[model samples]
Target: MPNTPTTYPAGLSRREVVAWRNGIFTIFALCGIGIASWMARTPAVKAALDVSTAEMGILIFAIAIGSILGLLLSSHLLARFGAIAVMSACFVVAPVGLVVAGLAVTLGQLYWVAFAGLAIFGVGMATCDVAMNLSGAVNERILGRTIMPVFHAFFSFGTMIGAGLGALAELLHVSIALQAGIVSAVMFAVGLLAVRMTQSETVLHVPDETDAAAPDGWRSRLAIWKDPRTLLIGLIVLGMAFAEGSANDWLSLAAVEGHGVDRPTGAVVFGIFVTAMTLGRLTGPRVLDRYGRVPVLRASAVLAALGLLIFIFVPVLWIAIVGVVLWGLGSALGFPTGMSAAADDPRTAAARVSAVATIGYCAFLVGPPLIGFLGEHFGLLHALLLVLVLIVVAGVASGSARDRTKTL
Candidate 1:
């Protein structure tokens, strides 16, 4: 981190504004498709490769590693190269990764392809997320009203489409390879379409400046660590990310394992979860505006805890639906709000947020497989219990963050 006097103009070039907005949605749409399809067909994939839960857990790491690589480097890379170039490039790789994963056979290959695809997917997502947040915050500064949550609605919509598409593909018995090719082609097309919308240049860049890289330097990120409030916010975000990760990756397995739901039905539970989450997010801004992100988070945490408790103790499949919905709604705001809390400012806020987010989402990358492994050895019910404990930690993070976010 060398800060490059990062600031957007009083107004962007019309082209930049259009490009940023459109590109953000484009990536979100693609991600929703990939994630939904994966979740929906988790059992099929597992069966095809003859993977036990532990093996599946190991394979999920590929996704996490890619996410870590993407987030940790995205800041400096974008700062050095600019947003559109990075975003467009990452988006292009997303589908290619999907195709590779679809064709993977051995557990090792699944891990490689899934992680590689997810990494590119993660990179594409990170790029879009950061750019829009940066752009949205800039818009808020210039226009003086909130617009982020609404923009995020598109992401929710994308998730819905992705999940639906996945379920449909599965019902049709589309080969994973063929379905993935479909996904990849779509992603590529979207990326190519998106490229036309990006700002060829940025206001955030420092002109006539050739920047030198630091070798042993963690100095840029180090600044955030030294600030107690910043450190706390980062931890809070990490907790939230962890909680959300468990929910996204494990909820289906929990339903299947703990409640004895069939594979197809269990996968659909995750769709229900995402659907509830997307609905919550789409409506969350109104609530956040009326009260605040912190209160919303605390309530969400308690709600999520209750949901998990239901999944564990209830034992009836019919009753578990309510629990999953509660879980979904509970989780909806944690990640996004945590990101907002981390950034919430102009200067280095974006970098700090991304850094915190990188650390936070690593939980998502690492958590699922670990849970899967734990479930393999112990039992999924026990894994769900562990997640409940983490949810409590996430709630605490949310409460701790409220004061700091206000300052930011």
Candidate 2:
């Protein structure tokens, strides 16, 4: 049976609320598919473009630039146009960007063209990410329980599907362009339907006349950065986002270059990581409801750190695979829990969620190039030690993510 909350958002029926939640689930999955589609094909893209790992990182940096712009723009856009409109526009933009990158890599083989496409895709993804998270937070409150992790679990499930398809494609010698075309087309079509199902309920922060900034204005939005609790939550997210994002960008490559696996096997290894993440997220809500956020987050950090250490140091392939599972389980909760923490007050949910997301995304911006440069000096496997240090920081900061609305 589906879990239903006693209360529903104003002007929405139980069916409508359920549909809205399902829509957010689809949107999250769409984002995952978009990310994994390209990420799973990274090795092939590198070969097609004839770039070294450092150069590949620079190319991936293009997505970071666009994502930053989108994150900066999200709150204001949501305030003005609302979540449905913003997400609808972004859904279209994301697929188009993916297709362009796909063609640029396979047909044109132009580095600059691929970079431009990825940047466009990044803008679409980041903006939609904030909007959907805000929407999900609202639904969580209406549902009167913690279901945020399930939304993210769907994302992991999408990655699992994408990695499976990618591995199959690689095995069958399918072109990246063709696979991207098929995947993006499916994303765009389903995404439009998903956007249509989301509720238009507003959660924009309302301010008084005495307030320094307007409710929907840039000053009010930027002011969220001043909140210490929000910043702490962002710190937690930053560490874990780096953990997950690093894997998305480099795990397959790491498996191939560091573990001496073939390309297909490397994709399979990444699939293992995604499967672990999906399981962790699927089970997260139950654990969170029982133990609360801080303890769970601390445990997550320890698991991720342990996994990273083993993955880096273990010479045995099977042992390292176990490390990947732990890393995935540990990386699963931080971002969603941080989003939930940031949105503890519905009045300020939009701005705070945007602010926290921007902070977390900084990890994505700096991580790729930093790891790549380090990998150039040290091996890719050893460079992953950087993830271990950040996981420790997240563990130390986990107390800040304790629920303020109500205790579990």
Candidate 3:
């Protein structure tokens, strides 16, 4: 008689699924966690000190300063502590930063504390972001299909949920300090518990020859970054990071300063934007697989551009929401698409991806502050128009990448 065939389970184990789910939760929480303080108290923070836009710009930069420091330090931290401990550290540190920001009595104290907290938060988050993406990219390759968009979609979902929850907290007259503390508790509990729930595929899964198609060595891997096609992909990532970070840092302020929307309504701006973004990313792969990468990227860029223009040029709140939804849809695939392309392409594969990620995230470190300055020096409405120009540039870059890689 023939030997009986072996069988596998039809669905993922509760544990296997949780690892993916928890990591996504942590990423999403990062986006929405700090905003509760900023969104609820921005006006108060501004009013308490009677500070001008330039001063406010400086304060905002302080947070970025912390984030930059975090970026610089992340690789080391990840190397020393490993991903689980590092994520756990961030989950703890970020909330403490929120608590400090909420309790500080003076603006300068607020600014300095916010900076220090963000530095710590950024370290955890920046490391988490890279490790998570690297893991997702490898998993996609191993699975022989696309999963990056779905991972990102969940991140978007976390942002939406966090933002909405923050808005609701503020609306209920929860003090800013109390609101921030509440979020801190939630993120901490979630993140700490998640440590056990998530596992790294890197440890469990090794690649086959097709998976490790490139030669093995630091030199061979590093050579990927030397390729021009890979650098072009980095440019696409840079543009998208600039646009997305700008929206994250400034969208609410735009609603308040430009359109005269009240704070709670303004706070909801990113929530709506991110909610739409989550939906778009969730559905994006089907479109990507069918249409190919180029047309979808071009369409996304155009949509992002159009949304920014509508938000900047038009005054109606509902109309602006429509624009944000469109922009979210347009910009949804930027990071995932760029990374996937970098990894798939023969010229660079992984190393170029590491380079692209490094440079692209560097853009994130500076992008938001630059937006704050522009909003300070230039009119808020006028400043936002710049996002369209950047998105257009990204469109060109991604579109060209698709064309060039096809030729390769």
Candidate 4:
């Protein structure tokens, strides 16, 4: 059965609800900007550290480790302090981690410093991710509609802005330290504003009878793990995460190496993918409302698989561009919709979301190295055939996202 609707604190005006929504949206955007800023400056950092590709890969893996750790702990923290408190704490931690990473380049033990800094940043990001999504989920219940995709669109816009700024900074020969510092400062200010905006808003706590009788700590988390619905939701998200992460990590490389495109042209292809994704996310909420989640998601998964097939099989640049658009649009909805699915039961939302997120992050931890290994023998374009398999899995699991009010 669908969970009962939650009642907000009495007397919250429509304008205040709108304000709170905007604040959560801003937080999502800031999270994207912070991560993208770090990613954009990675080349500069690699140059500074003089690390080989393998060594840099290890440093990247540290972030995943930290993120998994944070995801593991977030549900308990949410159960105790609530999403706003945990999110505010993460806002502070994330920028500090960024600054430390910036300074790490100057350290004598560069690799260790970079590793530690990225690990801290990852932890902050994971915690904030859960909290922000939980907050958005609660608000969705209050408003009684689909707004999560629009919130994610703001995140995509932030990534575009961060990437553009980082590119500009690189053109000007800006130091990675200066770039990270500027991003941190700007995001911190935004975080403060978001904190204030959300302070007055009431959080809806959906009552759960099972939760009252359940043990605290690992026992509770274990129970969540044992739930089939939560596990299925996690699998659904895993597929989407792989699809999205593969594109982010490999698209430009595949374009250049596999299709014989120049680096600049390959980057333009990547931009096309990002733009399509942003447009799809911006428009997805209405699509979800009208067609509902299962049909839309199943179609998206099929479309994404088709897009990948075209991009791989068709070597021509023009056809590849068409494939990029299809893939991006297809990839946009799955992650956010999976999140909404996990949070469908408001009472168990935090635990289920954490489980789903942890599984999703596993894709990031595993996808790159897996693809890189496959690329060694098959070449990058052919290696991406693996993603098509995951997309098929996602299509099969799309029924997991059916509205709780409806029979699956």
Q: Pick the candidate with the highest TM-score.
A: 4
Which run of 10 residues does model 3 get worst, by summed lDDT? 1-10
Least accurate 10 contiguous residues by lDDT in model 2: 203-212
Q: Give TM per candidate.
A: 0.77, 0.87, 0.72, 0.93
Residue runs of model 3 more than 4 Å from their true location after superposition: 1-22, 25-27, 34-39, 44-56, 76-82, 103-114, 168-180, 201-230, 249-272, 306-324, 342-354, 362-365, 368-382, 399-408
- Per-candidate local distance difference test: 0.66, 0.86, 0.65, 0.83
- Per-residue lDDT tens digits for candidate 3, residues 67-125, read 55555444444434545566677777777776666665243546556545545555555
Query: How well does candidate 1 match the true structure in TM-score terms?
Result: 0.77
All candidates in order of TM-score, best leading: 4, 2, 1, 3
Per model, how many backbone clashes are there? Answer: 3, 0, 1, 0
Clash count, predicted structure 4 = 0
Model 4, residue 283: distance off in Å is 0.7
lDDT of the structure predicted as candidate 3? 0.65
lDDT of 2 by residue, 128-208 (tens): 999999889888777767889999898877776777778788999999999989988988899999999987746333443
RMSD to true structure for each model, in Å: 5.8, 3.4, 6.3, 3.0
Q: Which candidate's lDDT is highest?
A: 2
- Shift of residue 322 alpha carbon in model 2, Å: 3.4
